[model samples]
Target: MTLDPPSTVSTTSRRGTATAATRVLGVLTIVMIGWLGVFGLLLSPADRDQGDAVRIMYVHVPSVWLAYLAFIVTALASAVHLFGKSHSMQADRVAGASAEIGVVFMAVTLVTGMLWGRITWGVYWQWDARLTTTALLFISYIGYLAVRGLEGSRSQRARRSAIVGLLAVLEVPLVHWSVRLWRSLHQEATVLGTDLDVSLDGLMLFSLFVGVVAFTLLFLWLLLHRSRVLTMIDLSAETGLDAALAQRRAEGGVTA
Candidate 1:
């Protein structure tokens, strides 16, 4: 028995699942945001050290985590495009969407981080290790987007962007390790290893937990929507090209 072409199989599967996946992501986004708003705004306890200012973490930390998650998606999609010849086009399109969304989230993370830092660290900017690496990560993607936006043939642009995507991913690991590798004012990871402080009360922890869930669902929803839009744009361009070619052929036939 012959196997279906990899592109045919991949496209078929993605099309079949796209609507359902989008719906699920949308519903989950609503639930997550609702919970986050309720808990983060009204329930989480004030920081004893920073007072209410510490509440920014609910937004800042989650945004940073989601930014990393988005970039990781971009990198994985780019890798698939570069190395998996069979599904290169599909992978590149997916990577494009992921990178676009990743950039948005990265922007949010940087803004929120700066706001939090100003209130807590007593400054709006710092050359701290984590901040610097995060800034570099943001710049790398900005460069990627610039390259992507430049005029080029579709395949040529895709290949070039894929390379950039892969290279930019190097910043992700650096961003994560920056706090550990250098002396920085940024706080270390809290949820992963440390014991929870009981003094803050259950409502506060619960609110933050809800915020994380909400932001994650929101990210998924946004990613799916962005991917769909990119795919539609690609399809529209292909259709326009085909129409132009058909018109030329008709004119030539008439002249003959």
Candidate 2:
């Protein structure tokens, strides 16, 4: 009889998820973050209105932008997983991993915003329209992640979570427009505004630009590692199940 190798034994040959590309990204992310810190903390002048508290923008804006970008990626990946001819589970893994990173970035955005609020608005919490919508967006994605954790076959989980992911991402646009749709205490976009005029000092603009680039690189680095980790996890689980079933069959034959 031909017998398959043990799952654990099969996986033992795989050392880790890291590759040359990931190592390069890791190095680039570290270097960019270092430059971001220098430009944000030392090179850029403080806002005339917000003072040193404005430094928080270096992190805050980039965090929210990355959150938006990550969620969009999750949605796109989900769509491909759901509708594409191949129905690839790789897309599902990407969706879940991106959502996880998005949640983390969203959390960072909220925390930094709160810190900025404490200094400028005199309170760490508010019911402002933009803040409220952003919180909801964060919670909705959290729910998406929870749905992904539900018990099911990989395909089943992927199908249901794909639906949820597509729906959850709808909130992103709402959160973005809430500032303009209502009288929000939250400030409107400066660089992203409809106006062509950007009033930020050259150094401030450069610092903010650096922050965005650094955060984007960080997100890519995280997504690459996370998706690969998820792939390994799925492999281990499937192989372990196969091993268990084979063992059960062997036992039954022996009993017979």
Give the top-scoring candidate (lDDT): 2
lDDT by residue for model 1 over 75-101, one digit each (tens)? 898888888857567677778877887
CA lDDT of each prediction against the hidden true structure: 0.77, 0.89
User: Residue-wise lDDT of candidate 2 within 1-256, one digit each (tens)?
Assistant: 1011223434676636666677898999999999999999998998899999999999999999999999999999999999999998889999999999999999999999999999999999899999999999999999999999999888999999999999989998889888878999988878877675787889999999999999999999888878877887888899999888888989888532
User: What's the C-alpha lDDT at position 93 in model 1?
Assistant: 73
TM-scores of all candidate predictions against the true structure: 0.85, 0.93
On TM-score, the leading prediction is 2
Model 1 quality (TM-score):
0.85
Kindly give the stretch of ten consecutive residues in candidate 1 with the minimal lDDT sum.
1-10
lDDT, candidate 2, residue 148? 98
Q: Which stretches of candidate 1 lie over 4 Å from their true place?
A: 1-21, 193-203, 254-256
* Inter-residue clash pairs, candidate 2: none
What CA root-mean-square deviation does each model show from the true structure? Answer: 5.3, 4.8
- Candidate 1 residue pairs in clash (backbone atoms < 3 Å): none
